[model samples]
Target: MHDFVRTPAAVVAALVLAVAAAATPAGAAPATPRWDHFGYDAENSSFNPHETVITPATVGRLKKKWSVELRSDQSCSSYGDPIVADGRVFISDYLGISAYATGNGAKLWSHDWVGSSNSPPSMAVADGVLVAGYTDCESMSDPNSGLIGLDVRTGKELWSGATAPLIIEIVIDKGVVVTAGSDIYNDTATVAVRVSDGKEAWRKEGRRIDVTSANGTVTGRDVNGTGTVAFDVTTGATRWTVTRNLSTGTASPAGDVFYGSSGDGDDLEAVSVRDGRVLWTAPDNDGVVAVDGTRVYCSDDNGIVALDSRTGKQLWRSDLPDHGALAATVAGGVVYTAGIALDATTGRVITGTPRLSFRSIVTGGVLYDSDNGTLTAYTVNG
Candidate 1:
């Protein structure tokens, strides 16, 4: 395995270089890419199309820019994945939800829930509002689960609205915030609320965990069984239902295609989001699926596998172990898995890439990784 070791002298040198790069002439700098949603967007695609840096050629030069200690110990937990928006990064955990400056890791603002617990919460940001879903600490059997909207710039509570129960996922699209999860009574639901005022727009029961919105529709898994369903984002009207059990987890949507695993075997399947038709299945390749414009990426027993999006043909496979738990984040023609960077087309590891001990997201020419109570930022040229 290729790795980059950072000694004390190397760290200081990297810091100086990062400071110098940040002093570049103002107008000459490119626009920084923003990851505004948990999975990068409403479709949970986990791919950044606007990234102009951190490509395979430059990934090996990545250096630590900043880091923040989220907690002192590992007993606590981080709620949802960290999201970057409007020059800041937001993260929720057992302590509370906090925002930090993406450039220097400075704390901008934070909000503490009255009765926060270990139960995970989901969050998404849009239109200057950050929507977070949480379960009150009263009782799990009859918990007061709901969504709260906060000012993304100031972290002030704007409004709160009720929802089903444990919110497994949240997505925002079409001027609404959509949430999906079930309660202790086994009543699963998908709820949508206005992003401006936290008012219920529509609610559909029987549609269970994990919701993703894109292309005028919201898709989720079934409540009682292992199927998938789609509904109109504005009116909660059923668009289509696929009875086939695609996967036990969430599916990543790219354009009109939904990619997921079957959970029963090493097969990654692609289904049409319009009609739930099985487009193709790539056998012996399954685990967290990420789709870009032309390829589908997933983790299997052997490592990371890339498939042709249209025909499900295996394009390339990288041989690595213990990668099944890491999701692939594609940006600038490179696939990032935990700490490894690989050529998206050829599946070759980029030598000297920093080996991170946790999952990471690359945006704005920097990589942000959080694990074991620490969030760190890396960049090739600050």
Candidate 2:
């Protein structure tokens, strides 16, 4: 062995090394924020615009782009998720909708209406038209529903119309305006109207609007509100609404429309409209996350699991010891279940589940209300 030699200064420096290490900054780049809102996009595309978000290691740290908070005292109670477009983000409170500057979360405009706690989410901005839904208290069991159209360039109401619906979902197809809602038997639940003047072009005699696809096809339920229906993009005619339920996870790929229940139970099914067939189902399932073309990532409120999207086969699972999942999202070849990550190919937990800044992960990012509501973006890297 070589002879040992140490200077007095060198010995002193070694004792101070621990202090320096803890102060080191996270040596990773920040991740791009993801816009994974439900019911897809303006045209109902489940495909997230930020499709590259695949892995935990690849996810960069992120800060809020902007946010608008509404207290129930102010008219809403964390009741719904906000919608994003071009550069503006739209938020809906128990009262109505607000348009905000996405770059800075500044309030640009606000709209309101009195609705129940179970009010469905609604919003759309396309070709200079902004639309939102409103409830009709005319009847209790089956009331009329409608949408308000506004000038997309400026938050101004352009036109208003009636759908005779209860719950509504709006989308654009091939440059045409479309919206749907639930109605009674022999009821016109799904209706497509011209965005320019809010004129009825096609109205399915009986159906309910649940979710939509980018291509304009819609997925919904039947009269009782638990079956399934896929209405035409252009004519509001019935494509097909199977009896199965749908999966409610992260937004799906663009134009992949389906329906399923999320309140509870082991069964959650979502079919694709591209071919009008049952795409996948989770029978022994707990809750689910995002599904890429290849694999379906899922978790119970306790652990993470993987399934083959095409065949509904089990891939693998990992322990999520303390927390439950929020939504499963995939980007950069890694799968995110709630907050943890599993290798896409091996179904192994590569990273432990992360603590959430907030429980409402759908609206965008979450902020700690303690530190003056410090908004923290839930991302892979930054």
Candidate 3:
């Protein structure tokens, strides 16, 4: 509509611009594989399907790619779980929130919440937005707690909302951000917030609240003997409620199923995500549960057991060297626990690397040992 330059120089510039645009594909600039939430996704699967490079044949040769100390002075400790997304790794610790380059562990950016309550922040990332729970340490008896959302690339604050007293865990799923915290009354509560904007969706009161989700539904167990409840992830409507003696306060979700332990802390049970119906039960289980889409892994004081996710049938059980001291992460056909990597199907220790630190996470063929602050990448050696 306006007057345009039609000279020879303008024509050459137009040709150069067109060539440059053709060189790059749409959304190709920053597209990368991301481990966006706790347990890799809303299901807390702890399983990575995109990780084809690290397999049973190659896990032994995994070498340390790089490591970054979140607390260089050892003044604070890293808490909660980290998330890998947008070509970066984000972590929240006692010191503050920080991000690193996923490939090399180079420090990208960091933010210090000056009044931190000496607790670690649990974080989740979605669509370049990082959400984390933190507490203000103005006093030991009464500290302010809240959740903050930041721009994943720049570490800029997007929005924040104050709630509860101690925000411990966070999960982002189905466009809903849920956070659990212990209120001032010593009871735990789960607060659901909309992801598009920092707004409260619903709040429920309980104790030892452990939250998990799958298929647009979220579940939690109020370890105060109130049992478990499932709710619609988007609307926060109660879908089902099951009253059982759930003392462990932990549950793992896989699709429409979840596994939990009883108040006696010995019997492990699986329940339906739809109507809270008990599907199957395995006795003498300690209820430390994790699902890898195909199998349900549970640990007790004596050992670890593998159950078929569909039928709750016992596949194999492995005795732990640490006597269940270390938690388990099931992925890539390997059950990593207590510094031992076991074949998931056979329950045989594949490698006693001893370097498999407690509370480590595997994503995109890399094992991140948060216990010692190290990141190791794996490859299949020919």
Model number with the top lDDT: 1
Model 3 compared with the native: what TM-score? 0.81
Q: Give per-residue lDDT, candidate 3, residue 43.
A: 64
Model 2 off-target regions past 4 Å? 1-37, 42-55, 58-60, 63-79, 114-120, 136-144, 168-188, 219-230, 238-282, 286-289, 298-301, 318-326, 329-382
Please state the error at residue 109 of candidate 1 in Å: 0.6
Clash count (model 1, backbone only) = 0
**Alpha-carbon RMSD, each predicted model:** 7.7, 13.9, 12.4
Ranked by lDDT, the better of candidates 1 and 2 is 1
Compared with the true structure, the alpha-carbon lDDT of candidate 3 equals 0.62
Give Cα distance to truth, residue 104, candidate 3, Å. Answer: 1.7
If the candidates were sorted by their lDDT against the true structure, best first, what order would they fall in? 1, 3, 2
TM-score per prediction, in order, is: 0.83, 0.64, 0.81
Consecutive 10-residue window with the lowest summed lDDT within model 3: 1-10
Q: Write the per-residue lDDT of candidate 1 for residues 1-382, one digit (tens) a residue.
A: 0000000000112332353356455567654567776567666777766565677668889899999877332433344457788899888766778899998999999888776545546677778888777666666557666688899999999999866555656667777876767667776877778889999998877775344565656566666666677778778888987776664233444447766666466677777778878888878765544666667777776587777778989887788765452666777777777567777768887888876754577788888887766788999954
Better of 1 and 2 by TM-score: 1
Local distance difference test scores for all models: 0.68, 0.48, 0.62
- Candidate 3 per-residue lDDT over residues 23-62, each given as its tens digit: 5477555224566765566666655444444546557777
